[model samples]
Target: MTIQRHVPATDAADRAMLEGWLDYHRQTLAQKCEGLTDEQLRTASVPPSDLSLMGLVRHMADVERGWYRRVLAGEDAEPLHYDEADPDGDFHLTGTETWQEAYTTWQAEMDVARRNAAGFGLDDLARGRHRSGERFTLRWIHTHMIEEYARHNGHADLLRERLDGATGD
Candidate 1:
């Protein structure tokens, strides 16, 4: 394993740097999913699990919709990519979906997330009380989403590499 070190941010504002990290991962994830066919995108290189590149795109879309649109906006809406009726529906077979559709949906979701992020004050309070009684603010959710994207991007790196030896950071 190789560790890459990023230089300390020269930017004065901590929040901007954090936002940059979030945007960076969002873009990185998109790049990782670029230019693959539907079969390649949905192919589970590792059996017994349905972790596909296309699936990740769908999942991230759901995350953005759920977090920014639903949780942050406090909207009463059904969850995307998730259902008690079919827990694995999103990943298993995205249903003859064209590459453009998948990519477009991912881009749209990211756009919404960006718009939502723009509306927040540096000190804006975003609160969500978890089922476990833990509370989170918008700042926390923003950072957490960045962490989520970064972690999944790592998985994407390996999975894509395994598929075509096309590895990247």
Candidate 2:
């Protein structure tokens, strides 16, 4: 599918700006994976790293679940693509998962995240805590998600370029 990334407005309010940039980064990752075959999406960036576009998509799906459903909404949401036994299972594809499946899952998680966040204001405290036992404000989660997506999107840029010579912001 084609992905269109809209630039965040320069003068938007804090929450709007954060959500805008977070979504922009999310679409950036999707755009990087566009037009690639399943093999290409599953191809690792380098040996021993296991970082692939498909893996990143799966990872972000879990990330959205973790921060939004598990933390913010206080739901007992389990990781969809990973488990305690294999903490990084999302990044280690088994070749049985189709691109459409992974994309659909990621999109679904994003939808849930949006719904979960909608009930709370930016300054509201989350119902869950970090592994370190620190509580999170919705503002912090939004900022952290933006940073997380931005970093992963950078990896996606390199992976896409290596796969097909495609590169962009």
Question: Which candidate leads in lDDT?
Answer: 2
Task: Give per-model TM-scores.
Answer: 0.84, 0.97
Candidate 1 lDDT over residue span 1-169, tens digit each: 2223343367747677777787778778777766677788877766677788888888888887777766665555465677888876667665586567777887787788778767766556544444355545678778889899999898899778877888877
Q: Local distance difference test, per candidate? A: 0.73, 0.91
Model 1 spans > 4 angstroms off: 1-9, 127-135
Model 1: lDDT of residue 96: 80
Candidate 2: tens digits of C-alpha lDDT, residues 1-169: 5799999899999989999998999899999999999999999966668899999999999999999998888899888988889999999898887889999999999999999999999999999877678889999999999999999988998889888898888
Q: How many backbone clashes does candidate 1 have?
A: 0
